[model samples]
Target: MGDKVISERLVGTSTVHGRTLEVHRLTWRDAPGLSYDVVDGATGELLTVDESFDEVPRLDQLCELLEAQQKIGTSSPRP
Candidate 1:
């Protein structure tokens, strides 16, 4: 099998309750893909996606997103 390529970009954001929400656009190489999780920086609460993307995402793509999020001052909540 060929190495699959995954990429992510910050698409937009939405406000929830009273927090600044960051949105990410994820793209995957093929079918039979993966899912993602969002975590709150302050309260350590995990947030689920309110909607689904047109394509299922990949693990690497999610990791890249997490990295980008960290650089932008957002991070996964403490587990």
Candidate 2:
């Protein structure tokens, strides 16, 4: 889907195979809800996140690991 870019940033970085692995979270327009991507740092590949729920300030929630984001997802999406 071709969605507008709202925000993107480096969540963290790590050393993998002697290369800098940058963890990222990219948010795109998804109509009423937003679409986010968790890409692999080293290869810039998409990581699968099996989550779907209404949450506002989604960026903050996506910034953390999957385990840490469990508690959030009942709010509303941002405009």
Candidate 3:
């Protein structure tokens, strides 16, 4: 299934106990539904499953947090 990015946003530290979050929007044709997945990227591990759009919002929130953490880990440390 072809995946397309629909929307993305950042979850501020205030919402994540002092951590930033990166929320992504994806659309797939085969599934024909809204879903979210969290990947380690560093290890290529699938941290989470394909969550449906209607259930709970936790998946989306978690993904956002993961993305934020990844960004922080990859960027150069401030002196």
**For this target, which candidate reaches the highest lDDT against the unseen true structure?**
1
Residue 19 C-alpha lDDT in model 3 = 40
- Best candidate according to TM-score: 1
lDDT of 3 at 63: 54
Q: Where does candidate 2 stray beyond 4 Å?
A: 31-79
lDDT of 3 at 59: 47
Which rank order by lDDT, best down to worst?
Answer: 1, 2, 3
After best superposition, candidate 3 residue 52: deviation in angstroms? Answer: 7.1
Tens digit of lDDT per residue, candidate 2, span 1-79?
A: 3366667666565553344434544566665444444444545544334543233324334445333423653322222
Task: List runs of model 3 lying over 4 Å from the truth.
Answer: 1-14, 37-79
RMSD of each: 11.0, 9.8, 9.0
Window of ten residues with lowest summed lDDT in model 3: 8-17
Better of 2 and 3 by TM-score: 2
Error of 1 at 19 (Å): 1.0
Q: Would you estimate the TM-scores of all the predictions?
A: 0.38, 0.37, 0.34
For model 2 the TM-score comes to 0.37
For lDDT, candidate 1 versus 3, the one ahead is 1
The positional error of residue 14 in candidate 2, measured at the CA in angstroms, is 1.1
